[model samples]
Target chain A: MARPDNARYQETHEWGRLEKDGTVTIGITDFAVDQLNDLTFVDLPEKGDKVTRGEAFGEIESVKAVSDLISPVSGKIVAVNDGVDGDDFSALKKDAFGAGWLIKVKPDNAKELDKAKSLADYEKQLAEEAH
Target chain B: MQETPLRAEHERLGARMVDFAGWYMPVTYTNIMEEHRRVRTKVGLFDVSHMGRYWFSGRDHIKFIDKLVTNDRAGMKPGQIRYSLMLNGQGGALDDVLVYGAGDDATMLVVNAGNRPKIWDWIQRQRKGFVVDVTDMSTDYAMIALQGPESANLLNKVSEVDTKALKYYRFTRGTVFGEPEVLVSRTGYTGEDGFELIMPQAKAAYFWRELLNVGESLGAGPAGLGARDTLRLEAGMPLYGHELEEHINPLEAGLDWAVKLEKEDFIGKDATVAIKAKGLEHRLVGLNIAGKRIPRQGQDVLRDGKKVGTIASGTKSPWLDEIIATAFVPANMAEVGMSFQLEFPGKGTRTMKPEEMRQTALVVPMPFYKRPGKK
Candidate 1:
């Protein structure tokens, strides 16, 4: 998959893209989706729910198992994606980086984005893990 | 990890291999959801060579087997398959198995791969006085199951057997893909019209690829253990470790049809009769999740304010589009429409009482989804 150059990734397989409006959009990475087999249901936080970085904010269930969706950036949830809570799961598998963006948060600390891994670094980590 | 005859074939098809019961088996060829849906609607092939296949011969084989299992096999004709249970002295399950009467003096027993060694040892230890020649044919044969509604037509195209004429629970020896001596049995664990083929180990890969080639036009795909589990669960079939165990009796597991109490005597007959007379303490009941959360095994089931049972098997049903589970609870509380609280995370804290728990599951009928025809 073509990784977006501007998107930053967390070690736990979540990706965060900082928008021009100072809010960050978060979604699970394509690798996470592949590892999960097939995404059946995703539970997302309601609007205005506070999300902390490195903590579980919601959960994603696949056909075989369930996993926690870890937050990449800490902030108050400003907006949520309808697809996450809805029945259509194609977004999570097909357009994970774009239409599948799960939640948007107004960052508590803007400097935290620097700590996230770049697209190249994230791909390298995935390659090493596969070996 | 031990490998089946089709292990390389599974890897060639990009299967996700896992360590299942000490064997490296395919968990899924494509994705579990797609494979599961395909089998329910169409046809799918499963490589079940890892399951133990044992053969008993000699003049006293039938009598010897009748003394060992709970099912009545005295009237079983040649080329007939009977599902039965091997139990200990306490009526606890040793393993659930399928017995096939090959001829007047010979029989075959197919058992779970995980319980193969234990069942084999148990059978051998019990055969001291009987004049039966026991042989472990597990390593000598390969087993494959073609399951679903389209299985018969798809199999008829590749095999010499007239599968359409074969009745349910019937078997016959025939040629499949030019390989002779294949035991084609019209039986399956999936609640659909299907057949199982047992043949030589050397012909497994050849037949596996050939069957897929012939059935490709019919939308028959290679399914793995993942799809197998969901299909059986939807069929209300009890898995060995999940619904049965060394302590769980056939009566409580709802397998009374296979337990012949009216027969003269067999292993565990005395205890099973006693248990039947006294009634059951815990009954295996189906639980349908009222919410989207999955009911995981070993999760606490609460009634009122106390834990009443634990979940045995659960999965998200692709066919029903709902979460379903099987659990053992008090017989009185196992009635239909009875409600129980499932310990789902984020529903509430543990200190919350039963009524306070936000998420609840209802006791529903088993076989969350049934196929069109009756078995």
Candidate 2:
């Protein structure tokens, strides 16, 4: 469950990385992937769908339950991961930082401080918590 | 939170522990879906040692039990076990359990782990006459459910008793793994052909390890609670806390078959009869989610725009690879091929397909499922 070098993380365990033209790629972190395993189906929003921060944009169906995929940042869905459909879901853990990227988003605020924090910062936040 | 004796073993296996009904139990080992798949495709062992055990004794034990539980204990043979529910005077379920008559004077009752204290209190209150001494022996005993495809074969390797002659729902009490163990019933909460081995606390871990070793060449693996839920869901079985609770009666939950109206008398018998005569408005039904989304407990079940029922339990079947759910709907919606929309809390609403739902789920008919034979 190690953090990848290129991706930044949200407090909600989402990882994101900005592309060349400022389009951001977003997906859940490795820790999140490990937490919700054996995903049978994913309900992602349409490519042009609008999402708000703290709102659920989709759902993930595991064996015992279906949990919501809460949006970590307000954005417009530009592209969903091509591999999320059918049975090509290897990236959810294998290359979670890259191919597992859920969608490309144009943030509501281009200059907004991304919710993603550094790896050490994320680890520190979890460490301070009372589990 | 309380810990079972197998808590150490679960932790050692890298299980993800969760707080289940005030007990710290393993929710999964690798992951719920993978564990679910493992059990369906091959074998999965489960450490269900936390479940409660009660021993009813004395000369009138059979009479006491016949008047205690909702099942028809009068006709129940010595070696046969029956799934039954202990009900309150109001017909509300106190706890569901498996009843195995060790002897006419001694009968063993395996109750849910969480409801041990409640059921014991109820038992003490009910045992007034008939010379039955109710004893709570849960702490002294441990139970292991060796479920899935290869359970019978694996048990045959170690036990002296002839398990092949032992039919389903039957048990043969004898020595097992060098312990004073009772291997009478192949009944378990999981929907599989499996045997539940009961023993004293001292010899439990050794038997569990030995079973794992015994099933090694046959591809048997230790399963967690994750797969158990999925297997039961796939077979359209009801969970106690979710589907059958203190506020829920067996009749309303579609478990009236467990309650015998022909019996002389039992706890909640009159109330069950009254409820049956007056009829029930809400009844539990199985759901096959139309879309990919799964509906979990506490979620609302809707139709058109009306609130119909609430989801009691839900899971994605690893065998079928579809979302399965149990919900208590109105009598009208309880029928097969009745389409309803479900609004999952936190997750958006999805319309359930009526034809697909009915084809996928039945009314939890008799036996529910005929488990795949191990040997």
- The lDDT values for all models are 0.86, 0.74
lDDT by residue for model 1 (A7-113), tens: 99988899999999999999989888887776666767778888888888877777677787788778998888987563467888888899888889999986787
Error of 2 at A2 (Å): 3.0
TM-scores for chain A over all candidates = 0.94, 0.82
Worst 10 residues of 2 chain B by lDDT: B348-357
Query: Docking quality tier of candidate 2?
Result: acceptable
Candidate 1 scores a chain A TM-score of 0.94
Runs in model 2 lying further than 4 Å from the true structure: A5-8, A18-23, A46-50, A75-78, A85-88, A108-117, A124-131, B59-61, B128-131, B182-184, B343-369, B372-375
For candidate 1, lDDT tens digit of each residue in B177-279? Answer: 8888799999888787889999899989998998899998889999999889888898899999989999999999999999999888889999998988898
Query: With candidate 2 superimposed using the best TM-score fit, by how many Å does residue B234's alpha carbon deviate from the native?
Result: 2.1
Provide C-alpha RMSD values for all models, in order: 3.7, 3.9
DockQ of every model listed?
Answer: 0.22, 0.35
lDDT: worst 10-residue window of model 1 chain B: B347-356
Per-model TM against the reference:
0.87, 0.86
